[model samples]
Target: MARATLIGFSAVAMWALLALLTDASGSMPPFELSAICFAIGTCVGLAARIFSPPPPVRERIPPQVWLIGIAGLFGYHFFYFTALRNAPAVEASLIAYLWPLLIVLGSALMPGEKLAWNHVAGALLGLAGTVLIVTKGGGLAFDARYGFGYAMAGVCALLWSSYSLLSRRFPEVPTTVVTWFCAATSLLSLVCHLALEETVWPEGAVQWLAVLGLGLMPVGAAFYAWDIGVKRGNIQILGAASYAAPLLSTLVLIAAGFAEPSWRILAACVLITGGAVLAAKSMLFGRDAKASAGAGA
Candidate 1:
């Protein structure tokens, strides 16, 4: 199979896992959910690092590599959470998902990338789909508070894109180290969760299960697959493929019965899928040329 196809499927799988975890979190305290995700993720990362045969050391990574990742991970959670706090879910989601557009803009600053008119149109179409997802069936009537939230999410989106770009700087360092940093950063989140979200322990086995699931999937595994995809495939193609995350997430939500199978949702999925295909087809079609291969855990 083509490398791009594999990357695309794994990326979409991560989004589905995220959506499934959200449904799982319903019975759990948010803290437990957050804690277990980070904690187990840390463990999983450590295990992977210990057992895997090392590749040629990319370079002697300095402490600054970790420091940057730690900071970036903190910003990712901080901005996302604060955005949710400052605005409604719908508006916040719309703005937060704009990270790819931020990527498009940031490409000029990065090496070997350019933003073309096709990129802009693809981004706009994805944004329109996001608006539909965020508003649900309500359409685009947004309040000032929600607008503020969207702006905050916009900030978070840029921060994330910056992090994604910066990730290239730490090539040889195990992804687990960064995941560990992210886990620790959630200490700050843990404190906030205590103060604002209330309660500490998960209520029951069901909640515990939810927490475990989040940790294993999004926190532990998805990123590992993504890192591999970066190494083995085209970065530009993978970046474009990320637009599918939101679309696949919607499908997961529908399967969980949180959302109906509506026409708008269907249409949004079509637009996103088609755009992703356009954006990624080159990497996909030339399978022999860029045959990326990875084992998804």
Candidate 2:
């Protein structure tokens, strides 16, 4: 349990680096960065596959899983990079953190998953947090130029939330199958990059370092660690802890001199994290109630 918690924390740290790294990805088109980063991740996945064999033929994954998962993964990163490109890193990241809340709400749609009142309440709280962040604490003077980027970040949240729900529906799919997902996302990102952006590699060593760091840490090994932690660790704690990614990322950005800490950001964090805790209360603490309700039904 301790080891799993450590690994989960490490995964969260890696995820926390994503926003800062993406912000440092200067002048690289979003699709281009997506292709390059996922390509590196594909290599990592392939190497993992080589060292550790896949499941037997009887447990082969379906094409639909591949399509849906790859689409979600690729789409999330694509828009994520775009969001960082156009919007403030802290704000964009805070908006994207809405995924966890979305996941809790979306889960109710799954078979046998009930829509508890806390879930709706949490969703509303999260939405309010988003509004606070997006509106800059109700000042109401938003930059229209960044609207597309903000919208893209919202789409990123939806993509990841949907992906997570779909993954729950296909729990039989092995974690090792992420190799295929990396491969497919790499291919799609490549096509998009080639068609939409000019062929330009990282401009300098700093950018190159950022790109490599992103591919290896956030896109590559973080997912592996998360899988291990979720399979072996206290998942409820990890789920709650995952909300810290944006907060940590924002701190890292401020530390790196990219942005300044502000009241609105802190308030948004409070609201979002508070809402996540509220929404997850039943899952974390209401096991007796859940079982009793089920038995009664």
Q: What is the C-alpha RMSD of each candidate to the true structure, in Å?
A: 3.7, 5.5
- lDDT for each residue of candidate 2 in 230-289, tens digit (9 for 90 to 100): 444434444445666666677788899987889978886887688667765764467654
How do all models score by TM-score?
Answer: 0.83, 0.73
What is the number of residue pairs that collide in model 1? 0
Error of 2 at 265 (Å): 3.5
**Which stretch of 10 consecutive residues in model 2 shows the poorest summed lDDT?**
288-297
Q: In model 2, what lDDT does residue 24 have?
A: 78
Segments of candidate 1 deviating more than 4 angstroms: 1-5, 27-32, 55-59, 114-116, 146-148, 194-196, 230-232, 285-297
lDDT of 2: 0.72
Predicted candidate 1, C-alpha RMSD = 3.7
Task: Report lDDT (Cα) of residue 265, candidate 2.
Answer: 82
